[model samples]
Target: MAYAIRPFRKHDAAALADLTLAAIRSLGAERYSDEQVAAWASRHGTADRFVVRAATGDAIFVASDADDRPVAYALVGMRGKEVGHVDMLYCHPDHARKGLADELLAQVEHHCRAHKVTRLFTEASELARGPFERAGYTVTHRRDFAIPHEGREVAIHNYAMEKPLT
Candidate 1:
């Protein structure tokens, strides 16, 4: 199936929220334990979250189906207008392995470059590590952390990766 990459729209917020949860519950289950998955997913809010992020200056890109519905999306943030951060990237399970995430990331890199961003970094989930690495990001370290879930701490680990755009 063919997909198009474009800047985010307000209506896409709900779809992005749904896609985010599905990606976390589906693909995220492959490498993460039940507790970890729950904790990770708990961090995601509703469509308002996406709207707020976009409103706050984060650049969001969406990969849409031919019908104009979002299938994958990526969120990027710029700090001091020079450092870029890949804050979130997710694809619906049905759309996985179709190069959507890759294209979205490429769009992000291009967007970052256009804004004079020189370095890109992210805390990449285990499932996302391979894709980020393939995009030329090197793992800086394995970041182990914990999140509060249902009154207890759930442990999780992801790679801290970075790519030099210069």
Candidate 2:
């Protein structure tokens, strides 16, 4: 199947929201409890927020299908001239392992470099650790934290990783 990568459009916000939830609920379910998954994925359902975020200066890339609907997306934020953060990366399960994420990750680094970003960082979920490591990012540390959700707390652990673009 052929996939296309492009800058995210405002209309893509809803699709990205759906894709985010699906990816989390399915791919993240193995290591996360139901409450944790819900707490995490629930925010992706905020359509307006994602749309506004797409318009932010951040480089938000979406991988689309032949029909032009997004199947995967990655959001990277710039803190200054030298620091970039990979904030979110998700692929629909149906599109998993088909190289869409690989393309997105490469595009992220390319975008960051073009903007003079020399250090790329990401807080990668358990499932995302291997791929980020394979892409030359090293784990700086791992943190366990709780996210307050629906009047309760949900526990999660993720790795802080970095790759030097220099």
Candidate 3:
């Protein structure tokens, strides 16, 4: 079934939180340890955080499944005045590999084009790198980030990718 893409609503916060963790935990295994995925998902802080950030941006898009539940989401926002960043993109595990990410990314690119953004970038997770690369994004570098998990700091790795839109 085709997904329904829309701007994020306040009611989506709780569902987005759940989707985020499910997506990461199930799909991140190829590139990260279970502990790393856990740490990354926990960094979301709270559902309120997602709601606030989604509202702050002009291009927070969520894709709903046939049941009208959010299955995937993407955020494309200005880093300055000319650059767009893909801050987050995730597909619920149940819907993985169904092209939800590509659809969400297409929405992000639409926002960038409409806003005159010359370039778009993201720190992409392992599972996300493939789609970005296929869509013409290049990896500028690989980086490791530390996040707090349980009582200690855990490291997660990602690729810094960029695509020139202009």
Candidate 4:
């Protein structure tokens, strides 16, 4: 399916949050307890919060359909001197593997380059490592831990990946 890539808008916050939660659940729930997942969702999935975050100059890009409904997104920002972070990147489950993620990443890379960012980093779940690696991010470390979920703790591991964009 064809999708339009554009700057994320304040009105897109709710949809963005929903998309993020859905993508995380679809890809990482096995490693997260229900409570932990719920807690994280509650904290980060609010539309208003996303609006505020995006309004502050954080570069957010969204992929939408003809109707302007968002189907995928990527959030990127500079964290420090020469360091850019991929805060998040998600595509609707139905839209997976269609190159939306790549498009989003490209946007982020462009943003980083514009800012003269020399390093780009992101934490990738097991399912995401392959794609990030293919995109030229090298795995720097892997860490395992338990996250609080619905009623218990769940085990999960994440790979810290980085790419030199300079």
User: What are the Cα lDDT values of the candidates?
Assistant: 0.91, 0.86, 0.83, 0.77
Measured on C-alpha atoms, candidate 3 has an lDDT of 0.83
After superposition, candidate 2 runs with Cα above 4 Å error: 79-83
Task: Please give, for residues 1-166, the per-residue lDDT of candidate 3 as tens digits.
Answer: 8779888888888888888888877887767898897888777636786776666664678999877888889877665542588888988888889887888888888888888888999999989998888778999999987998899999888999999888
- The top-ranked prediction according to lDDT is 1
Counting clashing residue pairs in each candidate, in order, gives 0, 0, 0, 7
Model number with the top TM-score: 1
lDDT of 1 at 156: 93
Which pairs clash in the backbone of model 1?
Answer: none
What's the ranking of the predictions by TM-score, best on top? 1, 2, 3, 4
Worst 10-residue lDDT window for candidate 1 reads 77-86
Candidate 3 segments exceeding 4 Å error: 79-83
Kindly list the per-residue Cα lDDT of model 1 for residues 75-156, writing each as its tens digit: 9986554249899999999999888878888999999999888899999999899889889999999999899999999989
Off by over 4 Å in 4: 29-43, 79-83
Q: Clashing pairs in model 3?
A: none
lDDT of 4 at 106: 83
Candidate 1 local distance difference test against the native? 0.91
Better of 1 and 3 by lDDT: 1
Off by over 4 Å in 1: 79-83
